[model samples]
Target: MTPISQLSPRLLWQFFDTLCSIPHPSGHEAALRQWIADWAVERGLDVMQDAVGNLIIRKAASAGMEKRKGVILQAHMDMVPQANADTDHNFTTDPIQPYIDGDWVRARGTTLGADNGIGLSACMAVLADDKVQHGPLEVLLTIDEESGMTGAFGLAPGLLQGDILLNTDSEQDGDVYMGCAGGVDANITLPYEAEPVPAGHQALRLTITGLRGGHSGINIHQGRASANKLLAELLMDISQHAELRLSELDGGTLRNAIAREASALLTLPADAMDTLSALLERRQQQYRCEFAGIDDFIRLELAPATMPARVMSTSLQQRLSDALLACPHGVMEMSRSMDGVVQSSTNLGVIGTRPEHIHVQCLIRSLNDEGRNRVAEMTAAVFRLAGARCNFDGAYPGWQPDPDSAVMQLLLDTHKELFDVLPEVKVIHAGLECGLFKAVYPGWDMVSFGPTIQGAHSPDERVHIEAVSRFWQLLVRVLKQIPER
Candidate 1:
């Protein structure tokens, strides 16, 4: 295997390559954590790994930079493990198949892991570079940032000696992220009765696949299609036109992602099959036209399903479909503070319809706790109206923006000096580890910046290759300009 340094450096590509070589999916980051520890120890640097598996590598102040204030460079080590069912790769133990595609680097049929991996790669690059002048640096790499941010939430307070912290986890290269939305995951359970298949009704599975899916928070306002929503729409329409009886319904995998594909098993009325097929054709075309520019590969298909021993009650099926249709799935409001910034949004992430009860999961995000709760309440209301039980989790707070931080000024000025342009400063609707970090390190001045990455949390995730150089330049510049104590 080619070393990571052959294609990229500051240890950037190399560390990313090594990281990809290991399977650091969410809670399963032990191997990667141990590998990172060994890497730090091999360089004779002081390293620490917390109980939660958040790793920190400390490099003593460099020469004259010793007297300067200490700084913390942070990034998450885990990636959202997403792959198509047809892909042979196993995220639990397989290396990412990364390749250069013109300006971007992407994985084969899986998420590129650039969301935080780029941030991780950037930190590794800085640490491996001896030429970059800077004060004492501590690289704080956390685990499980994708699912629950357990690593961030579990971080001990005052563990770092640094007063200035830089988070290299934001997506856009030309953006300095100051704040972000807080979020929570909610699950609703609806217990319903099911019966065995009725004779004389043909059993078929309606599958809808190939829709373009993306991050729920960042792309929610775009009005992209949701698999759960699409399946419900089709099934509801079928119910109107035919005496359809549902057996099973399933869609989506991650609660933080916009659902892309869905499948449903049902028995169609003998006479309405033709009408249903025609309606589906028309609906497909209509949806294609509606999202022609966004989702070019939307599909709807009906295929034979093996006979099942159970089927949902007619009332239950109707209630489930109605609940999904009534629930909100997109942007609720735009930022009043930042122009074009999404302030509040909801994602109807996953749905599973079994013979017993249906399970639905939704992730809600907002800069305000009240707004977040409001959206959650609105979501639960739908389930309640449909006679389904609802449950909510503790809400995570948003990172309150710090505009006057010294680090922000340094990064802003550094960008202007090198790139000849001002970086965009805004808050994102998506969750980040920074919020939890801030809760513990309240005194730390923080700002997040990174290379351009796209399609995170989805199989199409990729990082801009050339931007890596620019990102390296920015980090080196900021480090070199750190003020002396």
Candidate 2:
């Protein structure tokens, strides 16, 4: 029960603790935005809300530093809301309960919001302190970054007057991110007509749990299982041996997250129950062997359940199963230039049964336009051919790298001076808001860096204690040395 404010770099942690007290999950940042706006006004700083609810807070330069280049500190205000299935937590109304583990800060039964929360906190600390020397400073806090790039897309040009933008959203304290992948969301809906359950049918619930589902982009190359895709495969296989009808299905909640759990209600002939159960057991063993070291805790089970009055039509059931199996999941291509980097990937993020039809969500990520388009096209084709309507939504461009950037050199030199070791420059597979910024502000010289965070977009998310201290130190140095315009 250690107080988060007592952690090293008290100012940043103090701000983070306050953020945790406010529920700011994706698409619900109004409360947090109001709190920040009022706080800035109290300090006599200039703040304004954009058309899309993005906050732009401005503070004048420190004494004798007005001649330096203007810098914009950027981060998202929303966090992915994820909690353990058994935990009784409500993200919309409940404050995140964070506690200290050995060397990290974790939340009880939910995500810690460390992906962009920690970065945004550093901005708060700087804005409140007049002692930190910097040029004319601006903080751009965007909304709905976890679910969609709503704020980034709606950002109008001629708003931010900064020469450079310092993005604090990337994980890994030392690795400097100059570029990131673009992505498109594939929203598929398949129509279904439920038929009354056959007289000879019996119902059972099949569940798959215990997979270490991390961020769909950051952890795509690790070969961890996707619960939605896995459950689809299991249902399809078991159906071949018996007359199986799907009653209900759901797995994974967010389209941008790797699915960690899935479940389905199925109806089959009572006599064929033992055979289907046996087949499920066999497939579970095969899955364990495939994802052996990566997802060692994978579990597949079936239990007796009350019989439902109706089930999906056999045609719709088969088509849904066929589409899910054919849908692309995991790394599709590797970067030729960067060793061990994913060039293109797609995650079968979520699948669920709604009132009228079944819907599927898949997120495609790629460094190049061609790669991203190719995967999006492929994902759409799979669902379309299976008698479902598909859409390509939230399509954002990739952030191309600037190897010769002056801002990058300033950061690298600052790091070399402080830590004695140069930080590695990288282009991550994850979707960052920097790419969207290019559409409005093309002249921005941006470099993204932050404290080490692991298991983002999952309930196991945590931020490193020591890395936050170094992250703050590096940021403070970079702010002071932004080049003269």
Candidate 3:
């Protein structure tokens, strides 16, 4: 069946359906990039690709609108690769199976790639439409935005020559995003040694599950229980109240997402098993009550295990547990200017103990370079206090909004002219390529807006089919209303 016939808002359904038939997961966007070029060439548009695989497709101004200003429409081509553990969808080569669920478009057991792919589709749809009125248009499709933003970061100077840029990457439809938080990935490591344990000690597995994990920046202040922190706290309590030897500890997957589940195998004295189980039950009840609103599914369970007797030394175990507890996670600071907005945050997303090293990964974000550095320093300080060696990489600046920007005024006017209602302008908590683009093209005015997308970076990701039409309508109005310089 044709995609347009399967969903509402014909243009959006057609665009989204075409996007799903391609595999554009982060770091695997070569095919999508080439496809975009082919699509542009088919329309007789001038398309070019940067060395780092950023596509810029140019279309002339609509008839009678040639005197209007030129505008750049930007969207990333990559999507976060995520799937339920039970899902067999392979992101490396398989196309996203976009299906309609009422007004939303979702994939089958995999991420829908609507986070930015929808934005890309919207831009492409506008480019192909011969009837849509607009100025000189340039569509920039960047690669590798989900994982590292390598395409934006690696953009060669002087490739784009637009004075105003519209980033179609925001998740909300009514909100106009002008600023985003800067971020850095901090990697921490600790030395550890595992040895055979006494024969009398028993093995037990401790598991924490059902936590409501989300985007660290968007949901950090919600107090959702982190699986890594929960497991670490329980182990610390056991390490203090009872004699416990750590055999293996592992939790979390991505370094950016809050851990939802964690498991630890350890050796404990047979005499202490009953007391430990009782303590765990009490703690679980206490935490359930604490996170009742944020994570109603929080669970902690203990069961016997048949693991080998090898274990980490008590000293090493103490150090690791202390570090995990001390390292700060979640919202660290609130925005001074924006009410209820997070200014800076850190996510203790992953923890694992290997044969020779205990590794921890944290994602830090802030609106300013100084604030980002502050959070990074705070995290490193905690690691240092716990005697762990810390390292950091992949640092990028934040996009600062200009309240009096000429393009912002044009957008405000255009939005009002089309809908008779003003769009809510604000900053977003997540990281975007706007920050990197600003660095490359200083003095360029930029704003981001998109259709409603939910559950990004997760399997439940979906996009509102109707919002795409609204988004397209607003974007076309903005382009047509651009004033001459």
Candidate 4:
């Protein structure tokens, strides 16, 4: 494995390597915050912390650049903690182990945190480097961005003095983002009755794994299968041909991640084992063919397990399965206004059967407020029909595009001059902190861009090495070209 210190743009990689060693998962950014504050204080820079743990580090302008517009470099400090089912790692205590894999840098068996970590590292590099020419700079590092926008939501008004904000949380390189989708979370729950297992029935655990689950918003259009939806379909199909009772059900990890694995404990007639095996094989083949290009390693496993004492009643089982099948899990509509842009989508992100009730959660995203509301209502209606109560929360607004802004032009011209090619300027479907920032700081101009990262929010997450260098160059040049206030 190649050491990250040897990677080009040494300072950026060095900071990122150190960041990976700290446990900074969403809602647990205290250690990282202290480290960042200490690093800034060691250099005699001004560091301020808000009530909600958002950090603001100030750097003075270099010689002859005091009159340039103040720019805010923004990124989140928390990361989504995810790992493979077999990897024995804990996000709260264990450090992320990253190594070079060809052209990318990936963690051993967990998320690499490069989504915003790389962005934050760029800001650190700029603050540490005296050779880079720039105006007065404020680096805004927020908390709990991956799980919720708590830090951004609680940011006080008038906390920042910058006129323009440059967000570095985007995933793709060479693409400047002017706008992003807004999102809301929908939670549904249904109560059930438990019954004793029937005579002559055997217990089995059905496991689904090997799917390449990814970020729900970014990969929703790629036709990757959702384990919750797929398992529901299988259970529904099996219930038609066999006397099966569901005892336990669980899948997925977060409200914003597509489920890669699911499991169900079931009691079925002993004679039906052969039939169930054949059905699973057939469905597995069908799914493999459907998701060929993106998810080729899909697998279904069945093993004998200790018999559960009780199982869901017939009426409740049927209703829960029906609700799961009816729930939407992919792109609902595309933007007619912007070519090739996703307008509305939903991810049935998590499902679990608890002692008192069965819970289902989803994340809906859209470019416009009306579209976001429409999808949330539609998803709620699906569960409501099955006698489940639904609630929507954690709603965040979308960032509107500004094509004529001076900062946008500066970034465009800088990229063209540096690379001799025009960069793509467009809006993305993923949620970004800029939307939340815009709500409080209405007059501030904003744009987002970052190095290329793949499989974020998943164990396969990796960052492209060369793209980080290119992104650093672009950022430094853009800092030098900030317009006079």
What order do candidates take by TM-score, descending?
Answer: 4, 2, 1, 3
Question: Model 4, residue 239: displacement in angstroms?
Answer: 0.7
Residue 460 displacement in candidate 4 (angstroms): 1.2
- Which residue runs of candidate 3 sit more than 4 Å off their true CA positions? 1-5, 270-273, 303-309
Clashing pairs in 3: none
Give one digit per residue, the lDDT tens place, for model 4 in 386-410. Answer: 8999999999999999877788888
**Model 4 has how many clashing residue pairs?**
0
TM-scores for the candidates: 0.97, 0.98, 0.93, 0.99
lDDT of 3 by residue, 309-410 (tens): 578877778878888888889888899999988899989888887778888999999999888999899899988987889998988888998887888877
The C-alpha RMSD in Å for every predicted model, in order, reads: 1.5, 1.3, 2.3, 1.1
Q: Candidate 2, 38: how far from true, in Å? A: 1.0
TM-score of 3: 0.93
Candidate 1 lDDT over residue span 1-485, tens digit each: 44334655436887787777888888888898888888889989899988788998998877888988888999998888888757887788898888878878889899988888878877877777787788989999998888888888889986789878888888887888889899998998999678767777888989988877889887788888998898888888888888889888899988998998889988875677789889999999988898889987899998887877778888888888898888998998888878998888999898986546788999999998888999998998889999989898746889989868888889999999999999988887889778878888888888888888888888988888778778888988898888876
Candidate that beats the other on lDDT, 2 or 4, i.e. the better one: 4
lDDT of predicted model 2: 0.92
Candidate achieving higher lDDT, 1 or 3: 1
Q: Write down the lDDT of every candidate, Cα atoms only.
A: 0.85, 0.92, 0.83, 0.93
